[model samples]
Target: MSLIHVNDDNFASMVQKGGVTMAEFGAPWCPPCKVLLPILEELSAELGDSVPILTVDVDESPVSAGRFGVMAMPTVIVFHDGEPVEKLVGLRSKAAYAAVLAKAAALSPESPAAAR
Candidate 1:
């Protein structure tokens, strides 16, 4: 699956949807964010349709960034049922992201992963 691009217009609705939503908040120029992209992509692939992974450019979507209190680039947030359950900053390993996804899935009542 591909990463969904989120903006101020759709950010609220995207994360507010039931189940697990992973939102990566960063800018194009951020080096750490750039490094994190492929890792998240890999994690998304591993998770398949169990979780939705989203990317939001802080430069283009300041409203959503500010709302989430994103003080730095490469902020990854795992939202469960519209509430943020995990927040990570900087570049992290794919394993770390997988752990977060696992937590999100376990917490989401709508996730089929929870049945596994």
Candidate 2:
């Protein structure tokens, strides 16, 4: 599956859905956020429908960030179903993101949206 961009309108449904969702909380002004987009896309393509990669722009959706208690930009929060499974804050490498995704993939009981 392709990446899902989360906003105020879709936040509830995105979080409540089944399967693995890796939500990236980012701000357009942040340089690291720009660097991470392609990496996210690659990961999303690699994972396919088994896991869905979701991105939430902090500048676009402050409410979502506040709800997630995100104090910083570029926060990567992974969820299984309606619950959180893993979180990574600040700038990180593609390997790091993959490592977290791998953990989420292994830990999640059901197949990820990307794998589907």
Candidate 3:
């Protein structure tokens, strides 16, 4: 599965749809953000539909970025049931992101992963 691209317009709606959602707030000029893209893509495929992974370009979605207080270029926020639960700033290991997703999935009552 490919990472869903979101913007200020649809960011809230997409995350509020329910369950656990992982959103990466980044900018096109950010080298780390560019590097992290493929990692997120791999995670998106590994997690399948169990978790919805989204990408937001900070430059284009300043409203959403500012709403989340995303000061870094590659800030990853995990939301459960429309609420932010965990956040990671800057570059992190793929395993670190996976761990955060696992935690978010377990916290969301609507997530199929939560029942496991």
Candidate 4:
């Protein structure tokens, strides 16, 4: 799993990097965030080198989370080439989130990944 931990400092690059990215906006104390952790891990592992999955601790870097307009814990946002294209709040199944990723991947300009 390619999980990059982001704080106030590294959020810009994390969001603006190439390819599709699924970034989880969460707080350490949020139970739903804890629940979604494993699903993100499995997603990162399964997606291999194609898409990147990252975690943002809102408690530490509220700026990034706020910039993305993440108003709640366990919010998932998909960014493609630095622009957000989709968002989901609360806990969601892997398949549901995967569909979001698939759509983001397909929508990215010049991205070669096939939409599933």
lDDT of 1 at 47: 69
Model 2 residue 108 CA deviation in Å = 3.0
Candidate 3 lDDT over residue span 34-100, tens digit each: 9999999999888788888999999999999999999987999999888999999999999999988
**lDDT (Cα, 0-100) at 44 in candidate 4:** 85
> Which pairs of residues collide in candidate 4?
none
- Model 2 scores worst on lDDT over the 10 consecutive residues at 107-116
- Residues 1-116 of candidate 4 have per-residue lDDT tens digits of 56778888987776756778889999879999999998999888888767878899998987888888989889999988888889999999999998998888887656645444
Q: What TM-score number comes out for model 4? A: 0.90
TM-score of each: 0.91, 0.87, 0.92, 0.90
Alpha carbon lDDT at 6, candidate 3: 91
Q: Could you list the CA RMSD of all candidates, in the order they appear?
A: 1.6, 2.4, 1.6, 1.7
State the lDDT of candidate 1 residue by residue for 1-116, as single tens digits.
Answer: 87889899988888756788899999888899989998888877866777889999999999999988999889999998889989998878888888887777887656875664
Give lDDT for model 3.
0.89
* Model 1 spans with C-alpha error above 4 angstroms: none
Per-residue lDDT tens digits for candidate 2, residues 36-99, read: 8899999888877677788999888989889888998799998877688888998889899888
Candidate number with the higher TM-score (2 or 3): 3
**Each candidate structure's count of clashing pairs:** 0, 12, 0, 0
Candidate 1 vs candidate 3, TM-score winner: 3
Q: What is the TM-score of candidate 3?
A: 0.92
- Return the top candidate by TM-score: 3
Better of 2 and 4 by TM-score: 4
